[model samples]
Target: MKKYFLKLYQYNAWSNKRVLGTLQRQNVNDPKILSLMGHVVAAQFLWLHRIKGLPPPDVKLWGEYSLDQLLKLSEKAGKEWLEFVESNDNFDRQLTYTNYVGEPYTNNVEMIMVHLVNHSSYHRAQVAMLLRQKGFEPINTDFITYDRVITGQLKE
Candidate 1:
């Protein structure tokens, strides 16, 4: 499970960098793309903090980070996730954390990790749509495509 999640995180990080880079080169100031990108990184930060049992009220779910800062924040979140995924001791552990609205919940680590990936994919699709409408070709972010590249099934 740990190894599987590590791959998923790798995919997540790869896809995010592509999207951020595309946005940076195209329209970094687009409000919708910026909002989506900001939310994606902000949510990741909050979840990582929660998983680490860190203090609440420190991370924001909808933080408005600058376009230039998205990559830095994404890199920081990737490092945090990689450190956790590299340690498999508690992969099946359940975590208890309160949501942004103060609603408490309990979820296993695996479920949380999967949710994080899916959440990012969902928002990425939204950003892709926005990018298309703005006459930009969004990066291909499918998980299987990423897997094929990583597994030597496809050329770079």
Candidate 2:
């Protein structure tokens, strides 16, 4: 289980970097893309804090961020999540945390980790869609793409 999650986290980090790089290369400053990416980064941090049994940070979920800021935060979140997954082996441990709306919920570590990756993937697709609508070609950040690159079947 740990090995599986570690691979997922590795792919998550790679895909995030790809998306951020594409945005930078295209000089994309679309407000929707920025907002969506910001939310993704913020949510990663929020979940990390929750998983560590800490209170959520006081910040807007959809706060505006400059491209550079988003890139930095995304990099930080990716590294931290990778480290967290690598160091923790208790995937079945239950975590109880409060939602942003003050609702309480309990979920195991494995489920939360999966949700984190899937959540980012969902927003990344949104970012891709917005880029396409603006006549920009979206970078391929699929899991298979990452796998192929890692296996030397494709160039990154």
Candidate No. with top TM-score: 2
lDDT of 1: 0.85
Q: What is the C-alpha local distance difference test score of each model?
A: 0.85, 0.90
Location of the lowest summed lDDT over 10 successive residues in candidate 2: 52-61
What candidate 1 gets wrong by more than 4 Å, as runs, is none
Write one digit per residue (lDDT tens) for candidate 2, span 79-118: 9988988888778999988888889999998899999999
**What lDDT score is found at residue 156 in candidate 1?**
46
Candidate 1, residues 10-125, lDDT tens digits: the string is 99998898899888888657877888888898888888878888875354567666777888988888887888888755678889888888998999978998999999999999
The TM-score of predicted model 2 comes to 0.96
Worst 10 residues of 1 by lDDT: 56-65
